[model samples]
Target: MTRTIRLRFFASVREAVGIAQEELALPDEVRTVGQVRSLLVARGGVWADALAEGRALRMAYNQQMTGADTPVGEGGEVAFFPPVTGG
Candidate 1:
């Protein structure tokens, strides 16, 4: 089944992805924050480069800082941002 989640991007991630937030419907295989990220990454191009695994990306689920493995479901929220930001 497919489900939807709110996606929030911050700092460099926002700059790179060129969006602050969005609502994305996910496939059944995408049940975790990591998988959500992977879904975006699969978009290729900037989505892949901006969210590349080689980068130090931080993830959150429902506003609580979490690892990519954190589970996500319909109407849940996920956030992505860099580890550090400039003043």
Candidate 2:
């Protein structure tokens, strides 16, 4: 069954999407954080440009920072944010 996942974007990603979050229904094959990012990129235009592989992106799964291989399950909140900056 397709699962609905929430995607939250911050910093540049947020600016690009003109929003902070999106709800998506994904298939079982999309089991990792990288897959989710890839799926969003396939939406084209802003999604593609913002999530480009060359860009630096930080991710979180269910509010906990995570790596690309992190598993994502139904009802999880996956967030994408730009590299942190503090000085």
Candidate 3:
């Protein structure tokens, strides 16, 4: 079965991906935010470096801050971005 979800990229992640948002059908193994990142990383090159595990990134589910383990359901929305700092 395939799970369809909306993905949103912000700031640097958006610049890297060259898109602000897109919809994708995820495979069965990808059920959480972390899994989605893993799948993107598997794309290698820019994707790998952008969403690399070592990168300091933040995530949200349906506009609510969430951890990597957060569950994602069909038609869900996920956003990725770098930590925000203001002085």
Task: Report RMSD (Å) for each prediction in the order shown.
Answer: 1.5, 0.9, 0.7
Off by over 4 Å in 1: 85-87
Q: For candidate 1, what is the lDDT?
A: 0.92
lDDT of 2 at 68: 90
The most accurate candidate by lDDT is 3
Supply the TM-score for candidate 3.
0.96
Off by over 4 Å in 3: none
TM-score of each: 0.92, 0.94, 0.96
Candidate 1: the clashing residue pairs are none
The RMSD (Cα, Å) of candidate 2 is 0.9
User: Candidates 1 and 3: which is better by TM-score?
Assistant: 3
lDDT of 3 by residue, 32-83 (tens): 9999989989999888989999999999999999999999999999999999
Q: What tens-digit string does per-residue lDDT give for candidate 2 at 1-87?
A: 889999898988899989998898997889999999998899899999999888899989999999999999999999999988899
By summed lDDT, which 10 consecutive residues of candidate 3 come out lowest? 37-46
- Between candidates 2 and 3, the lDDT winner: 3
Please count the clashing residue pairs in each candidate, in the order shown.
0, 0, 0
